[model samples]
Target: MPVLLDLRGAKSSDVAVGTSPISELQACLHSLAEPDHHLESRPWLTGIGESMSPGLGHRLTRFAPLWARRRCRLLLPLSPPLDVDMATELDRVSRLPENDFVAAAAYAVQGGSFDPRGAVTRPGEFVAACEARSFSRGELARSLIDDPGDFRRVLVRTLEDSVDAFFAKEWERIHGRLRDEVEQTRSRLRGLPLAEVLSSVSPAARPVRDGRAVRFDKLQNLTVPLGGNPVFLVPTIHGRPHLIIRGEPGFPVVLHYPVAWRGQPPSIDEVRQRLTILSDPARLSLCRHMVNEAITTSDLARRTGMTRPQVSRHLAKLRSAGLLTSERSGRYVYHRMDVHHLMGIGVELLRVIVR
Candidate 1:
């Protein structure tokens, strides 16, 4: 399936680069909820987990599914300014109508497909319909349908608590980097066609229909007509493994793309360290074995005729180099290669060498 963005009437002015703290905040929550897919942000995730109050932690866990793999669209600002801050965005969310909030939450709970009218007019029938599809977040959905006001209050409070606890500092630390990405993108737009820039944004994007539209290779089939509304390109550090596209009716489409390393190429020393780590034959062999499937150290040792200690030593080197991610299951820990990081090594090395 693919998502097509029709740009027939769109011009250079219709595409803009901007940063939204609300979107970044949602991205951060998604990364925290699904940490296994974002191994690069493990340190930040661990730090936030340790620092958050127990009550906040419990609330976040309760609402994890709302922002985990599919975020509630209402959490994102409808049309954020280029210099939008957290307070302004939160204010936007705090003012959403009860019906609109319920509809958006139901859409998220139903996995991006739901009837807003049904959610608003026929709440019981809507929940029944969701249950027919094996509703996983029934309680949250019910909370939204039965008492949207309370849900909205709790949602706002939880988000505010998140910002106060850690994201305010996180935003301050990364705001400059995000602003730089936006400026660089704007500069590129001055020279390149919008289609070319769209293709360059992600490997999964391609200019289609003779550049009249951009198609993203995604899981859902959707055709979004720009209709002269501006397209906002938001770059985020914590939005990896997910290129978020929110195209609600009557609002500008938002694309939250993943950016590597604060939008800068890795340093020479960083590239050198990774290359050096992968240069060892034992470690290379271990990586090869773990490329397609995660393998336990004991299993890898048995398959390679190496002792457990030797396999562990090699795995540690790969892990330290950011080339491997591990997950513990029962008594054994499974390690897998970080293919994206591995592929970026060559890009980083080339940039360093050429620059």
Candidate 2:
């Protein structure tokens, strides 16, 4: 099912573009939680994991329940100010009412609606309830239900410790880039329609009902009527491979979109090298197969009717050029093309040429 945003009667003022350090911190935690999908953050996460104390690391794990499968619903910023700092946002989160915090935690566990009226008194029953929803973090959920205040403390402490560990430096490094993206997006909004602006943020967004509404192909089914509330579009560098949306009632809808690549554009030589790598007929054929699915060398050999060594040689070249990514599943290693990078080659080349 798709998540629909009814934009009926929504004005330009109803949409806003901004950046939030707290949201980026949450994204960093999520990236650390699921490093496989977030390959871009693997090196940073590895470094933090090695340098941090084990006790602090364990405390970070307490947040795993809130980040079920790398998606979080707890402690999200609700229409945060454009210049909101991490301390201010964290303070806001720390001040949430106990019941609201518990309810948000429960929603995070199952990624669904929760009724506080149906709350269970015992920790065991709370865990059982979460388990029924396929949530495997029993102890964490139990802790949240048993003593919500202590859990809130631990959550806040873990976030604080994480900033001290690595997020502070990371945020400093990427803050300017995030702000640039927001400014550019807002500039676009000045000339483009809301639907076009939404689509530019994420390709999955589509305008519907003659631009009165927009829909996204999301994991959950939801219909949010703007009803005069604002929608915040937040861009994050660490939040790659995920587009998070929070549209709970009584709060402004927030969308955290990923911004790919950083620093500088590729040099002319690098662009030429990538173009040459893809110019080969056999490699282009291989890319056609790998673009949509990850396949093992043996599978590629069979499909292309080429020898194993030939397929390996081509795969190696693709991997070296950063056009391919591979993952090991048991005995077999599957390789897939980085479709986003591949698609951006034209823009990269144009940037270099124009420069």
Q: Please list the C-alpha lDDT of all candidates, in the order they appear.
A: 0.79, 0.76
Candidate 1 Cα errors over 4 Å, as ranges: 129-136, 261-355
TM match of model 1 to true structure:
0.73
Tens digits of per-residue lDDT for model 1, 1-355: 7888888887877877888888888888987887766666889899999888999988887777678757778766666475777888778777777677777778766554567567889888777766765555666667778888888889889999999999999999988988888888888888888888876666667899899889986777988887678788888877765677878776678887767554544555778899999999988888889999998998899998999999988888888888999999999889999998899787666444422
Per-residue accuracy of model 2 over 1-355 as CA lDDT, tens digit each: 7788887777777887888888888888776776765655678889988999998888777666576453555556754565688888888778776676676676666444444324444446557766676645666677777788888888888888888989899999999999899999999889988877876776556799888888876666888877588788889888764677777665678888877555444655777889999999999999999998999999999999899999999989988877999999999999999998898788666444322
Local lDDT at 149 for model 2: 86
TM-score of each: 0.73, 0.72
Which residue pairs show backbone clashes in model 1?
none
Q: Give the TM-score of candidate 2.
A: 0.72
